[model samples]
Target: NNMAEAIASAIISYKKEYFGSQADVNYDKTLSSKAAESTKSKRIADNKVLKARNSNVVFKVQFAAGNKKIKLNPSNFKGLKNVSVRTRNGSFYKYAYGDTSDYAVAKKDLKEVKSKGYTAAYIIAFRDGKSISVEEAIKL
Candidate 1:
């Protein structure tokens, strides 16, 4: 009988030390380190979403392209530091220019590309590494 009493006393003290004596009296006993960790994880996920929402919108001016290697060269297209030759849908070579997150800023860049002989240059946005409509990118 004495051994049983000592064990019970030890368990109660352990609970009080970890969960607090108030937790013992509560109807719900879900308070634990694991629950605290779950709350922290949810907060971390919410922070990521907020960061994505605040990210700058990006665009590029597609100047030229070809199903195969272009007759011309991308190196001679423009001197923009952000100019790049990217593969579209893994099929064609596309020469694009400019890097801006603002829509109005991209329009100004488009004008510059047009002046450089890329009259058909246009603005396009990307999301998660895939191209999307500028309208859609703005909405996001």
Candidate 2:
């Protein structure tokens, strides 16, 4: 992906440089305007693409506690792959099935789960089974 990005950038730059050298007055003005417009359009497109790629897909977790609820964010767990909710006192609970259910269970468990200073209800971007920055994940 990096290589592809580099090549695409080179091509765009090459086009800009090549077209910037027109001899005709009208042709040069038109080409320059078009190039500038193209560059602006590309920048906007790139921003959208980057935002989508880096955007995080968050999974909320909630657990039950008496009649209350506890919400757990991604940071609550060290390894989030096999997410499960259990009591901090050493009692294993059931695994949350759906995204909503899992988040609910995690929220409920938050009361018992010790916090390591992570925020609640935020997005988490992952790539190749490894966590990535939100900006990078948004590209996906």
Per-residue error (Å), model 1, residue 14: 65
**Per-model CA lDDT versus the true structure:** 0.53, 0.34
lDDT of 1 by residue, 1-140 (tens): 64475457447634443443321131123234323432333344344332224255566666555555443444566555567766545555666677666555666787788686665566666776676645455556
Pairs of residues at least 3 apart in sequence or in different chains that clash in candidate 1: none
Provide the RMSD of all predictions against the true structure, rounded to 1 decimal.
Answer: 25.1, 21.6
Among these predictions, the greatest TM-score belongs to 1
Clashes of each: 0, 30
CA deviation > 4 Å runs, candidate 1: 1-56, 68-75, 89-91
lDDT of 2: 0.34
The prediction achieving the highest lDDT against the true structure is 1
Give the lDDT of residue 103 in candidate 1.
54
lDDT of 1: 0.53
